[model samples]
Target: MGALDYVLAGVAAVFLGPEMFSLFGLPVSLALAMVVLGFLTGILVGATPGLGGPMAMAISLPILISLFGYSADALLPVMGFLIGVMKGATVGGAVPAILFNTPGTADAFMTTLDGYPMTQRGQARKALKVAHVSSAAGDTFSDIVLIVCAPFLAIMIERFLDLPEKTALLLLSLSFIATVVGGSAGKGLIATGLGLLAAFVGTGEDFYPRLSFGTEALSQGFGPAAVFLGVLIVGELFRGIEDLWREKARSGQVTQYDLSGDQSLGWADLRRLAPHIGRSALIGTAIGALPGIGSSLAATLGYTVAKARHKPGAGDPKMGEGAPEGVAATEAANSAVSGANLIPVLSLGIPGNVAAVFLILAAESIGGFTPGPSVFRFTETAVNPELVIAFGLFTMMMLANLMNWTVGGVFMRSLGFLVRVPRQLLLPVVLLLTLTSIYVETPRFEVILFTLGFGVLGYLMRRVGMSPLPFVIAYILGGRLEETARQAFAATGADPFFLFNRPVALALMVLALLVIVWSVRPKGEAS
Candidate 1:
């Protein structure tokens, strides 16, 4: 089939909403089932503190590998599950915040400002419904934007960028991501440097076993899957377990809130919140497109803007005092990040957030689907399989959105009783899952040890308030960055410093330096 034919076929499949169709011996129904399963699991996890989308993706990626093996067929179901988790987690986070005044995730902290107050006023159902609506709308909006833009962006890069420009752009991305994310710019860079160093070890031509330190086991570098899961999931599990153990004795029973009275939101309320949802969705899409800047900032900025612009009706209260629009603004903003986070991942192979990192990991591990400009290289002779898979992911995302829209309200409202599962109970299961998942991928005990070591490092990074986002990102991009730089260098065998003569590469270098300088500059210092 032609490339255009494949594109059109993928689009038709999406709109047709095929349930029983199978491709490459894999059924779309299975993918849909995974979407449902992952969404529910995400809701469960996200409603529980210390569990989020990364944990879900980390645990599931290897299991998916074990189930499906390394094949192109694995993409749809794996991506479906991951997308479901991302959306579900973002929406589910609002439940605990409103019901217990404890945010289910970091991004939902701001949601507590209004959500908890609404619960106190016996509007728990109202608050949850608002969260559901806005979250669905925001996610759908961001996803549509991603589907429209990512392929075009990739094609543009493929058309315009030479090796030197691509290499310089990657370097610029690394610098930008490092500085923009995490608690401290310096710490972010340090983490990124650690990742680059780790990734460079044992896997290059110059040194077949670079930094292997004479160990036979180190002859083969660590898999990106192990490193990512170990640092993000295993380490996080350990911390959560420690916290759970310490608090288990002090924490008796979770205080249950009464779900009584005035829970119904009128059509007028929806009308009032629609504009805020749309606006917050746009804000979040923009923020999420940028690497490293997370949903927490998006939610905060969304709520702040809504507050500044809010002129509530006579009966309606101001934000932070239980305004339903507050719920819409915060939830819409955070949830929108789920879909838009994939924008960078699809176009540049740079994951914008924790969930996207694993999506890249899954694609890489499954093989044949490398995300970058090359993925979107369209020609009359050959079909771009990745492009079609991108559409499949889009279809999965839409399925998840549909699920969220149809059942999200009921699920959130019912979660009051369902979320009684304690961290103490869940932590052990997650630990087991982590070990089993990693062992499935690599049967070696040493790999487990290496993973644990990375886990420990990740724990320490978290302890020091350093974000691991930059670390994982750099690790994932390190090989590609190196490859591109070498290609650029070889292309300019005449002069080692050839980027100086390349206008695009030079412009990117200048921009990167400016960004670093601006990032390092004192906030109070005059320019």
Candidate 2:
């Protein structure tokens, strides 16, 4: 595996060799360019009210695939870009949430609770700056966790786990995700079950395709990218456009803000937030490590915990009034989760969220890399002294953050001007970009059709009380769960009790059952 890792790295370097050169006595390596691009992309995606990191990645993947070709060298920049989007979007959500009382993403909803109030009081600059700094701090801290814990966790799994245990571990991971995410125990279980079912929609082993609906495309494995784009990106775009139209019909003017004030924070303000940063970072990292939990939940949880932990008469001026600490806590927690989410994906090959699942898919499509313990082995071989690759990844993320903070800040501050552009002009530009990007990836009209179809489904789901998170999560984990179950069954000659024979598997099954029961029990009865 180590040798294979080196070979892959070598191949990546070779493919990217032409792009590497010296400029101003600094190594302008291909990796460096990718990192910068990742950062820029993040800023662009984050600053937009409706756009998000995942959507940005979806749009970029196709373009990158066509331009760079499918190789690790090509893939690394895209990964860097995703990292940038993650960091940028974490903070960027605050913009619309604070100014217009519209959350760009669910995670930023908490921010708007107080943030918009501050804006109404003409403290928009202060709120924006606090949100930005706090987000950066949280994201940086989470990256530190990734740097420290990923290798250790990977080694533990690689050294100790057998197939049964690994399978059990993945099941346990899924259980934890469902428990933490769905809020109620029953809903989580139901959601997980639903996710598993969704994952089974395409072809499986045994030369049987389970739920293809007699379509030829169904006989082949479905494209994960297509599904993600359709359900998440396209759906959101349509919804955004519809909302824009509604806003137009109701009010002749789109929301606008004033950011001319000097709202920069001093060292004293930062010092006040230092304590909360530490706590929020921990919360975020822990939540991120768990499967199914997303950054938005982490942000809300961080805010709640921060409020709870406030000292009597600490008189945090920002509490409920959009205090800087509120921004810091939520931002840190949400941003930290980004790095933490990657831990499970890189170390154990289990995706913690929809973005991570897409990352795994992209890695497979471009680099032929299967994420898990084996990734470490192969990376060690391909890049040698695996630390270099790790360091490279870390460097890329750091660079992305730096770029995001500096460039993104300016862009956000200037957003008041950009939003001034007529909706008539802006909407068309956005639509064109979306259509062009979609076409570049699939080049099939059917892909666009599916995208629109899923977009409507997404809109409808939102209209109902259902969250799209569970559906997306289910879609991602579906295939893996089935494969593991099948493998377990085959190893035991299809014996129903075989899964129970193994202690680890038995334990997981018991725990999952207990969770299901506990989740369904009357709320007050158990708690």
Candidate 3:
């Protein structure tokens, strides 16, 4: 099949797939229905203070797998839902930040600076409109880039890289992620090492398990669903519960707002905000294309740049003082990050952020869809199913963007009540839901125990200022890394220093070392 033929086949697979039910006498594809459902659910979770996109994705993944089962036919519907959650949550996060000065995640913090101020000035609706429009536009721009660039990048990777080179490239990616993801390079490395250690505990080439210690349970290692939910969702819930306990009185208080005046976003308003949106969209896409940088940094950079360039006139607000442009800049940048983060995932099989992690996890669990250069291969005689699935994913994202542009604003603006739901009540419910869902999937008590154990580890990591992102990514890639290294060694006729023999591989390893050394350098010397 040619590239164009693969693209069309993918579109047909999504639109003409198995029917979930009939809507208005027309058959509704299961993937299409799940996308819409996930989008709406994403908005609800994103608006809540203690819940965000990653947590929702982690909690829902187990349930999704249980319901759909492990079949090739289940991949599209499962992936479509996850993609919807990712896109919807990016836009929904701005709602609570604008109306209630509550940010569900780090990326939404910048939105609160100007968003809450706008609410105080009775421009809450206007701020939300600006956020929604800017978010939709930025996301659209990033998706187009991903659609155009992923296949080209993947093809280039397939053409230029051999096994040894690929192994070295993976090392470079891991090292770069470890150094850049957290406050201290040392702590990040520690987290990465621990993740790799945990991943190595189960099976290997030997007849016996590598690190099982003669325990029957450890022989199988940890389940991916349990590990992800424990570290990402359960761990956060534990921390939130503790924080809320300390500030019970303050957390319980609810403030009422009189939202009135200039609620409409007119053509003139969009014209004024266009420059900020465009600049931040570019900034965010560039940053998000790199592994481990994340949307929080993009939001911060976007807000800082827009603030520096902002010139307030008479009867106008300053950048952080109820300016609609402030909301637009932050929201646009963070939203843009969500789509561009998928570029590395599709091209190199490397996840760049928490949301991308789940997408990779879904593909791994579902099987029949390996996310790498091979996924984009076009063969003349045989049909490439992964290529069709890739196109199907792009179509799902476009569907999500369409929903965002049409009815998303109306739905987002009506979510002010979510801010009033205290974490004290919400955290326990989420914890219970997560545990119950995990039990339903595996129906084993030991799996729950493993999840709790990992949850404690995750909580401690958070308390010590270490980010879990590096750990999670390392865990996901550890087995693949080992397999590639083994292949590279065999391919080079059992050469001990095979990496140093190839110029590209040697250069990548040297670059990886330099990245770590540079990250640990003194601020004055580095500058």
Per-candidate TM-score against the hidden true structure: 0.94, 0.85, 0.98
- lDDT of candidates 1 onward, in order: 0.83, 0.68, 0.89
Clashing pairs in 3: none
RMSD of 1: 3.0
Question: Per-prediction count of colliding residue pairs?
Answer: 0, 15, 0
Mark the 10 consecutive residues where model 2 has the least summed lDDT. Answer: 379-388
RMSD of 2: 4.1
The lDDT ranking, best first, is 3, 1, 2
For candidate 2, the lDDT comes to 0.68
* The 10-residue segment with the lowest total lDDT in model 3: 248-257
Displacement of residue 414 (Cα, Å) in model 1 is: 2.0
| TM-score: the better of candidates 2 and 3 | 3
Preferred candidate (lDDT higher): 1 or 3: 3
Alpha-carbon RMSD of each model: 3.0, 4.1, 1.5
Sort all candidates by TM-score, best to worst.
Answer: 3, 1, 2
Candidate 1 residue lDDT tens string, 376-406: 7666666667777777777778888889989
